[model samples]
Target: MKGKNIRLLRYAVQYWFLLFCIYIGYRFYLFVRHFETGGVSPFVSRPPSVEGFLPIAGFMSFKYFVLTGIIEPIHPAALFLFMAAVAVSLFFKKGFCGWICPVGTVSQSLWMAGERITGRNFRLPRWVDIPLRAVKYLAMGFFLVMIGLIIRTSMMVLFFITDYYKIVDVRTMKFFTEMSTATAVFLVVVGLMSIFYKNVWCRYLCPYGALLELVSKLSPARIRRNKKACINCGSCSKHCPALIDVQHSESVSSAECFGCLTCVSYCKGEGALQMTVKIPKKGIRSVRPVFYVVALLIVFYSFVFVAKVTNHWASGVSYQEYMKLLSKQGPTQREHPRLP
Candidate 1:
């Protein structure tokens, strides 16, 4: 019973988000399919939620907004989604990863399937694990250098208005639909690795996860352990997905902690591990899991609502423009006039 709440909550969130993502994907597919067939098929309005996949574009749009004080006409929803994710991490310690991300859900499912087949999960040696974890941070550094520092405002605006950027969402859809052999093999390898290890892609290769980790360090709420209540058992440590040593620590402040509350839920001793907000010189106050969930939902929806009200939620590109761009047989063939 002690561990039941976390499992239930985690599964509930994961499946709910996963289904929502599938619906968004289906809608986007129908929208693109109409153009792929030269508009002969029935039209379906494009779902703005599909722009959630365009994070790099989101960064560019955000930078453009900072520079020009205007939301870019293309992929405006991406910027809103990006902001919501960052806000969730800043306030709730990477709760977006544990509670909302579809990739995280799939990774967890793969590892759970592996456990059922093999009877347990396996961990890499400390030497191998430490270096592998560094990969994500290195990837994040590369993107920061490329997008954050090197790309200037003029360059961003130029890129934003390009045909390539304009049709990027279409290309992304095609990539999955017409997956090449190399891409298929790569995905298969990653999926296989995930089955053997917990969150293999997220722990080792996800630059997005690394970015969230950095933001989550600023979060006030954290997993707090009351050593006085602990009974010297290692159940929390054993169950932790991030591999943090929960029994020994007074508080789990590691950036790797996803705030899944698995550690808190697994603690057999009463009042042993809990989520708490640290106040300056005033000690700490416990934060219920339900409160964390509520806060995350409110922050995410509020930003979306604001975007809608400000006329920044929809793409300025019209269905006619998509039809013209996608009427070509292949992604490479689809081209628009370059901004000189």
Candidate 2:
């Protein structure tokens, strides 16, 4: 019991550091927008629609300029940072999901609440799990083949660079801070769905998660099993939030494995499962909790630092300016402008 308490304490401390890093990243973004443009306003904003060259990239206020072709604008820093994120996941597993994802936190909290309400835990069968996992991959392929490969490489390059892509200016953040009814409804449904399923959005739907999974399968850093230990208690499988059967397999069975080390903490068998450079009987000597925390911080801050550096050289002007310029020139072209 004392040992378990100690382990839990370590976990809490690690999470504290990771959370602090996330706070830093969030604050840094706000600070830049506030200072540079008078307040935390969107550099570009518009209704969620695909009619423009800068269609919604994600839930974030930013967009990938590489998606459009204007001045050959590409955020190399973000590209490298995202690449590094995938590379790190290869060794550390999906530390991003377990540690830093705000959505993951909400899902886990919901699962805990459900467990408290009903003594029975929710566990999906392997048949359901296998097919559900494929959805993320399909979504990823759609974006890659359709938007990334075909559109960016072909017609979008020509179509996106014109004035029709213009949408909104720096004032867009104010629009969101004061949410309309439709945005409120969307948020409510997302929140409810998150509570009902443990990372349902991330596990089965997120295209980014699918990309991470592909890279994570090749990660050298992993939890290995010792067949000789022989107890096969199956405790690790039960505790795995990803629902992976860690006990039976030499390697983690699913890409959903987030390297949270819950299995490592719960395992009673000596040297049964451990982290390793080369699947050691007992893995690395460093503090496991510290490693988890550091990895999470690295992922969060790397994204922020790149955003900050880019803002310096970025046109960073809003779409509203272009729209106004276009309106003055002639007719009010309802057609969204491409990246100028």
lDDT of 1 by residue, 1-340 (tens): 3469767977898799999999989988987776777656566778888888887788778777888898888789999998888898998898888888899999999999999999988999999999999999999999889998999998987887777887888888889889999999988998999998999988999999999999999999899889889997999998787878989999998998888888888888898989998888988889887777777789878889998898888887765567668864432333332211
Clashing pairs in 2: 90-219, 160-338, 163-337, 164-336, 164-337, 165-336, 165-337, 165-338, 166-337
- List, residue by residue over 1-340, the lDDT tens digit for candidate 2: 2337535654564466457545644443443343344322433332121111121222111223444323323222223345445556766788666655555665676766766776535655779977987898998888767665455344544443444332222223434556799988876775665555566777787787777777778766677788887488888887777878898888664788887777877887877777555445764443455555566567656654664465522332344454343333433334434332
TM-scores of the models, in the order given: 0.93, 0.64
Cα lDDT of all candidates, in order? 0.85, 0.56
- Lowest-scoring 10 consecutive residues by lDDT in candidate 1? 331-340
Instruction: Report the number of the highest-lDDT candidate.
Output: 1
Per-candidate clashes come to 0, 9
lDDT of 2 at 10: 42
